[model samples]
Target: MTPISQLSPRLLWQFFDTLCSIPHPSGHEAALRQWIADWAVERGLDVMQDAVGNLIIRKAASAGMEKRKGVILQAHMDMVPQANADTDHNFTTDPIQPYIDGDWVRARGTTLGADNGIGLSACMAVLADDKVQHGPLEVLLTIDEESGMTGAFGLAPGLLQGDILLNTDSEQDGDVYMGCAGGVDANITLPYEAEPVPAGHQALRLTITGLRGGHSGINIHQGRASANKLLAELLMDISQHAELRLSELDGGTLRNAIAREASALLTLPADAMDTLSALLERRQQQYRCEFAGIDDFIRLELAPATMPARVMSTSLQQRLSDALLACPHGVMEMSRSMDGVVQSSTNLGVIGTRPEHIHVQCLIRSLNDEGRNRVAEMTAAVFRLAGARCNFDGAYPGWQPDPDSAVMQLLLDTHKELFDVLPEVKVIHAGLECGLFKAVYPGWDMVSFGPTIQGAHSPDERVHIEAVSRFWQLLVRVLKQIPER
Candidate 1:
């Protein structure tokens, strides 16, 4: 295997390559954590790994930079493990198949892991570079940032000696992220009765696949299609036109992602099959036209399903479909503070319809706790109206923006000096580890910046290759300009 340094450096590509070589999916980051520890120890640097598996590598102040204030460079080590069912790769133990595609680097049929991996790669690059002048640096790499941010939430307070912290986890290269939305995951359970298949009704599975899916928070306002929503729409329409009886319904995998594909098993009325097929054709075309520019590969298909021993009650099926249709799935409001910034949004992430009860999961995000709760309440209301039980989790707070931080000024000025342009400063609707970090390190001045990455949390995730150089330049510049104590 080619070393990571052959294609990229500051240890950037190399560390990313090594990281990809290991399977650091969410809670399963032990191997990667141990590998990172060994890497730090091999360089004779002081390293620490917390109980939660958040790793920190400390490099003593460099020469004259010793007297300067200490700084913390942070990034998450885990990636959202997403792959198509047809892909042979196993995220639990397989290396990412990364390749250069013109300006971007992407994985084969899986998420590129650039969301935080780029941030991780950037930190590794800085640490491996001896030429970059800077004060004492501590690289704080956390685990499980994708699912629950357990690593961030579990971080001990005052563990770092640094007063200035830089988070290299934001997506856009030309953006300095100051704040972000807080979020929570909610699950609703609806217990319903099911019966065995009725004779004389043909059993078929309606599958809808190939829709373009993306991050729920960042792309929610775009009005992209949701698999759960699409399946419900089709099934509801079928119910109107035919005496359809549902057996099973399933869609989506991650609660933080916009659902892309869905499948449903049902028995169609003998006479309405033709009408249903025609309606589906028309609906497909209509949806294609509606999202022609966004989702070019939307599909709807009906295929034979093996006979099942159970089927949902007619009332239950109707209630489930109605609940999904009534629930909100997109942007609720735009930022009043930042122009074009999404302030509040909801994602109807996953749905599973079994013979017993249906399970639905939704992730809600907002800069305000009240707004977040409001959206959650609105979501639960739908389930309640449909006679389904609802449950909510503790809400995570948003990172309150710090505009006057010294680090922000340094990064802003550094960008202007090198790139000849001002970086965009805004808050994102998506969750980040920074919020939890801030809760513990309240005194730390923080700002997040990174290379351009796209399609995170989805199989199409990729990082801009050339931007890596620019990102390296920015980090080196900021480090070199750190003020002396």
Candidate 2:
């Protein structure tokens, strides 16, 4: 038995343990999908796979419950792959090692994969538990939800017969998400010339790490520092005083995650090394003070390195640095309709420099299409000024809230009856698969809720133990209370 199996809510945790044993990172979910299919087949449940790798498992209504409305339980199968810089774990081959930390479950120096894993486990438990009373059920397990909404985007119309969708992709416990933000990815490439390294210059690698990088859309309001932007600012400032030539620069991983670490290799005048070190120290202190409470663990280091054969041209380096420094990040606008809800935001998610060109990726999100487009255009304009080509792709629509949604009311009433408090109903700033499903099934009443997950999309991700139990009780009760069709 696994450590997770010993946790409370044995069925859900047992399924979660099994899931953690199979490597299911974004864009690589073949094995996990097969496992889920086999699990359903062994139990004699009807299963179907769509063209995009989405799995739909069906279970007949319980005795005396055939007249109740059918419910579709939805969760994404893939998880964002993130690990500490020094961790040697590989997302493709290594199984996530989830361990209990007090009242939470976390992975060592890597993401715990609990954002949707716990939710997926809950659905699996429902399917396997014969005692759980419910009407006809369809479990929709999607793929590639972390990196792209490929599964949701390709869902065919009329594939599901349920009138209500219960999305289990939400992170918070005491909230029922009625809607979510839409998002688009902006890819920018800047062509640059390489020049021979000048004589009498020393090479140094400047590294910025330990920042609390998090989900771009969900945590954008927390004021966490972006390593890419900070490195650009530092490079621009250093170039003003010293003759610096950039050789290589890279940071970040996923386009939807805020950059946590960045490093730049450059050659600078040998005589100015001391002054450059002093400047970096001062700037680090300044940033620490500015981001005191939110990302106080920020660190900047400088180390001597061997010289490179070629470096970026002075003009191109300056242009790239300036454009990155000018790029917009964090929350840009707040919604007037929903109090304290972020309306529009952008994350300077990644930066990479190669011999021929430099690449910069940004993720823009908004509650409305207009806000999303506005930010994408603004980001493009900034890079275009620096002779970079910018293009937006992988765009998805937002889920519009239905005030009269039957599913939402049912979930709310179930929560109040189970926990003695009403679960907050609000729109999320982050993208959820429910939006894409709505495009395929426009009339399906939808609501999203799940166990409490913190530090998602980062190495620090974890799930609350007690919250899972409460979440399970609420889900089971909601299933038992569905109105007759």
Query: Which is the leading candidate under lDDT?
Result: 2
The residue ranges of model 2 lying beyond 4 angstroms of the native Cα positions read none
lDDT by residue for model 2 over 187-301, one digit each (tens)?
9999968899999988999999999899898899988899998998999889888888899999999898999999999998889988898998899999999999988988889
TM-score of each: 0.97, 0.99
lDDT of 2 at 440: 83
Model 1, position 46, has a per-residue lDDT of 92
Candidate 2, residue 301: lDDT = 95
* Cα RMSD to the true fold for all candidates: 1.5, 0.9
13 in model 1: Cα distance from truth in Å?
Answer: 0.9
As a whole number from 0 to 100, the lDDT of residue 86 in candidate 1 is 72
